[model samples]
Target: MSSALVRNPGDGTNFRYYTNVIEQVVSNAETGGLATVTRSIARPDQAPPLHTHSREDESWIILSGRVRFWVGSTSLDECDVHEAEPGAFVYGPRSVPHTYQAITSTAELLIICNPGAIEGYFHEAGAADTRSDASHSLMEEYGFVIHGNPPPAPQTY
Candidate 1:
């Protein structure tokens, strides 16, 4: 049986992954492997490479600033792009290739993953001492397949 859990603002495990700040608010262990939640702050250059998850479905709720997300079931070259602002929600199902980039100076978003396994990846990869030498193995262990760089950000005239 699991007891109730509460996390106030700034009350979570925080770490820096690349240029993004990630806070794991709810762990899979606490929920008995049902779900995991995290809060992240990122800049435009902090966007992740194009990738697909083999295990969990991921969702995001935009909290502040603007972000552009590319989601597709088949390939990155053919995907739906969405520009979201505060209060926007996006979902990326398992096996779907997806990535997002902040369009404003800064963006804050809440990330949720079903079945909670991906939290392990975040915890390990976000460690300050983690080395790039093990990145491929770590990603494989976490059920992630890196495709390539995300599409270039849309140009503003």
Candidate 2:
């Protein structure tokens, strides 16, 4: 990825990734700046472990369906839940803990990571290739923090 790349609507490095999420790394780390594009298709009840990136800022451009995001705030009790819809944009600053779930039957998200430091985690975790309800331990190995086992109970606002 020494040079920038253009991916047609249906092209990129696609991976089954982890449970409930499908990922595609559009721009790799070698592209410079570690700026990367990752597309995700998430199904209902598909939520990621709560974690924070140590060196990258992330943004999600909602393409379809609905996503319930827990951002910045540590606990669901902090009342930071947000429901994002198509055409919505959500930003996660570096070092901030964030997590989300697809509330609808399915959701599509375009995530951009600048100065992406965990691209390798995507490769390895995506390789583990397991789709389950358990947490992903790899996130911690990639310099991200997994808050705890089992996320806090869902809070309805």
Name the candidate that leads on TM-score: 1
Q: What is the C-alpha lDDT of each candidate?
A: 0.82, 0.71
- The lowest-lDDT stretch of 10 consecutive residues in candidate 1 is 126-135
lDDT per residue, candidate 1, 1-157, as tens digits?
A: 2577889758988876755668888889888898999999867767878899999999999999888888884456777888998999999899999999888888899889998988878767754465452648989988999888856654421
lDDT of 2 by residue, 1-157 (tens): 6455667656775665655345565655456656778888866545667778887888999999888888775665563778899999999998888888777777788988877666667756653356332374666666777763334434332
Clashes of each: 0, 0
Q: Could you tell me how far off, in angstroms, the CA of residue 157 lies in candidate 2 after the best superposition?
A: 15
Runs of candidate 2 with Cα error greater than 4 angstroms are 1-4, 20-25, 127-138, 149-157
Local lDDT at 7 for model 1: 91
**Candidate 2 lowest-lDDT run of ten:** 148-157
Task: Please state the error at residue 57 of candidate 1 in Å.
Answer: 0.4
